[model samples]
Target: MPVLRPLPTQGAGRLADRYGRVATDLRLSLTDRCNLRCTYCMPAEGLDWMPSAQLLSDEEVVRLVRVGVERLGITTVRLTGGEPLLRRNLEGLVAALAGLEPRPVLALTTNGIGLAGRAEGLAAAGLDRINISLDTLEDDTFARLTRRRRLADVLAGVRAARSAGLNPVKINTVLMRGVNDHEAVSLLEWAMAEGVQLRFIEQMPLDAQHAWQRQTMVAAAEIWARLDARHPLVEDPADALARGSAPAELFRVAGTTHTVGIIAAVSKPFCGSCDRVRLTADGQIRTCLFSRSETDLRSALRSGVEDAELAGIWIAAITGKQAGHGIDDPSFLQPDRPMSAIGG
Candidate 1:
């Protein structure tokens, strides 16, 4: 039997692994398929998707998550996908995770189109929170960004999530300088009124689909400046101290109690505090979002690898994680794989 020991006091920080990095968050991709062709995530003619035979079964994903939580201190698991809702029987997966002795906080990131139909089922299965990707509120712009005219569907989904008790639903907007930057204030205003947390994200070149150009990228500081001019803002006391692993710079409107966030992934890379790992839909474990290397765990699972062997695989993958992603190099070329293929 594994002996229980007292945890050390570490200045409010989480327990770090042998690598001296805290491992508390796991992002598991359920599928490499998305219904929308967002220019930022996939090409107009999307690449061929992974075969069903290769992808990890829901059971496999849950098993891996159990090991990750037990051994790597993962207390939170966020379900992502090409669009997570696209995967069927998601509630089954959610239920399995919820059955844990001390269940981790279950959350999901989605494009929000299908959320309306699934929100109730998801919450009933023990999902705690949700993050919806809404780049623009305008129907035309929304259509342009996602190549789908489903703005109304997404909005309804947000409402459904709230109705289902997914409190403080987060809205993730990628601020493209000339494209959607103009809508920043409006988006926040809507989120504030709706009681949802809005987060403006800086565009990054993680995949080739975005057709990212330097001129189109806006910095987080600029976004803050634009928003601050309209309404006085203050740093959220909860987020004042840099936790090192958090992706968003959190702040709140001066007069309002609601909070908004900004994710500066491109201009300000938060590499030092990255304490999470990603598992693609097909079971390849990626330590970094921008990593080019991945360890194949699908084959191992299919070949009947024991829990000990699987744990060893995870250990090796974590150890191989790079100190930082080299996105600053001018010679840097975007990954050939589309975000959908890699489980964005």
Candidate 2:
């Protein structure tokens, strides 16, 4: 349980942090139990999964999101997880979120293992779009990175998402040196043929193993050079400017209308304009992904506080948000919660 700092006066009726960043995008984790053990995320044996009893119930999740949307002005809600597809009543939860007043733009970030079967149902339930994580195109490399032989299932889920009318079904790929870094060009080519959005993300230090080394990690410049070699790249100024607060930097695959995005979180940090907040599966509010401290909202919710009061707790949580993640700083330290538990 983290301490609740004093709530700063609500500025402009938004979830504003001290540095003037307002959070309208909410990443809400549905569960902490993931199916795949990605090398950069979890250990091979998997974590001691959170007891289901400790997680926020569907009803509790709805109430918290309602406070976020109605009271705090959250406009976008992204359902994330250790793996969101594992949640049994996901469709029902989606429908409930879709019914919020001034209904939010709902999305989901998944690993795409079981998404093939649920894509259509989720879209029908009001999911706006999806982002599936795919690090490599080769089955052998996929197995090496994720410790799972479900690359076929992941690809199928990408197609299923498109079939379900989730336009621009984005694929999030992490480039790790000596792992899947060689597949950058191949992965982009595959995504181009499939007509889905592809984003190359520089590996960050959110791994549960805490073995990430900057020297061993692939940088944005390396990824750009690799992809540019195969397909000449040009910056999409229009899209780049329009992508305000978006982490990815947009570039057009020259000679074609298709575009690619790169999220240089470590190399070209985007902490200055970040407008996102996260809610852990167990009901902690984190204003930053690298947050060392989180405010406990579950206790207040269980104590039977009104929605307006819950809104105050949420405000206090963001009051002390740091100026930046400071990954490049000499004093930088990884958060206690790994990416899986933190809800990327």
Candidate 3:
């Protein structure tokens, strides 16, 4: 690979769309392959996997990260996937990303099926933190929801990640009305006991069949009320730093500094403050998670495009970003791709 000319100071280049929201975070999907098929994330069978040759190489991912950091002023990155750990040589990619100049903060969103064995290597390779997707605490619920028998493995992975010093390990749970909503308080209590930060996400319309209905969503207000009824919640305003641009709204448990977060993406739209963009495993760049269109960077990259050209393609995608993802609108049309295809 040829070397590209370096840009000026890191924070000097601020990337913003027409809406004036600065883009400081990027989500890079490593692959679309995952071990488990979550009911809300993917169809049980016949998931179309992208040809391996079409996926970006480790060097390619690093180069884009460099362009993003140097040219677009992205300071934070999260590696997401159908399951990021399924990709071969992920630790190498982590190390490469960690070596960048003005190195951006790095993290991963994983299913945690095999994370128990990999946590130490990833932490040592300079990963900043991780968010594990674990919906219910029951093994029976796990099998029914995911159609898999890996609940024990995931729980073990969480313990291993904490033991490996993954600070404030976050567990992402999606609350489906009748599915996992009943466990809201139990999940919070579990997080408190285990010392892992817990975040409850409202189910979005990103499922495979477009079967997601508004009636299924458990509102953030309800989640809080349920938990508060059991254990009173007094807002802790001290976690102000984790508020802006972050999807999660943070609050401390009553009387103590322990925190709980609610990422109300649907009920409370935060598009105006959205600071993130996504790159699919197959190399399509999406400005919003609910975006109907994507810019094909893989085609451009394979054509041997220059750094400026690559940066321009990315900028064009961000420039066309809509004011907000119109999920609440009755006229909203779901994206053709599922969460797995869209990158976690």
Model 2 Cα lDDT, one tens digit per residue, 1-344: 12234344649556988767789999999998899999899899998888988899999999999999988999999999999999989999999999999899999999999888999999999999899999999999989888989999999999999999999899999988777788899889998999998999888899888888888889999999999999999997688779899999889999998889998988888887889999999999998888899999999999999987899888877877877888888889999888889898
Clashes of 3: 0
Per-residue lDDT tens digits of candidate 3, residues 1-344? 12223233223245667766779899999998889988887778849898999899888899888999988898999999989999899998999899998899999999899999999999999899999999999888899899998999999999989988988899999988877789999999999999999998888999887889887689989999998898787666656665788888887788766788898888888887789999998889999999999999989988999988899888878777887888867899999888887885
Model 1: colliding residue pairs: none
Question: After superposition on all CA atoms, how large is the RMSD of candidate 3?
Answer: 5.7
lDDT of each: 0.81, 0.90, 0.87
Q: Can you tell me which runs of candidate 2 are displaced by over 4 Å? A: 1-12
Which model is ahead, 1 or 3, in terms of TM-score?
A: 3
Best by TM-score: 2
TM-score of 2: 0.96
RMSD of each: 5.4, 3.5, 5.7
Candidate 3, poorest ten consecutive residues by summed lDDT: 1-10
- Model 2 lDDT-worst window of ten: 1-10
lDDT per residue, candidate 1, 1-344, as tens digits? 12223233321223343345666788889988888888777777776888898888888888888877766567899999888887878999899999875579998999898889899999999999899999998999989988889999999999999999998899989887667889988998999888899998888886555577766688898999999999777996667786457898889899878788988877787776777888899898887777778889888988898877887777767766655666776766666556676654
Q: What TM-score does each of the candidates earn?
A: 0.92, 0.96, 0.95
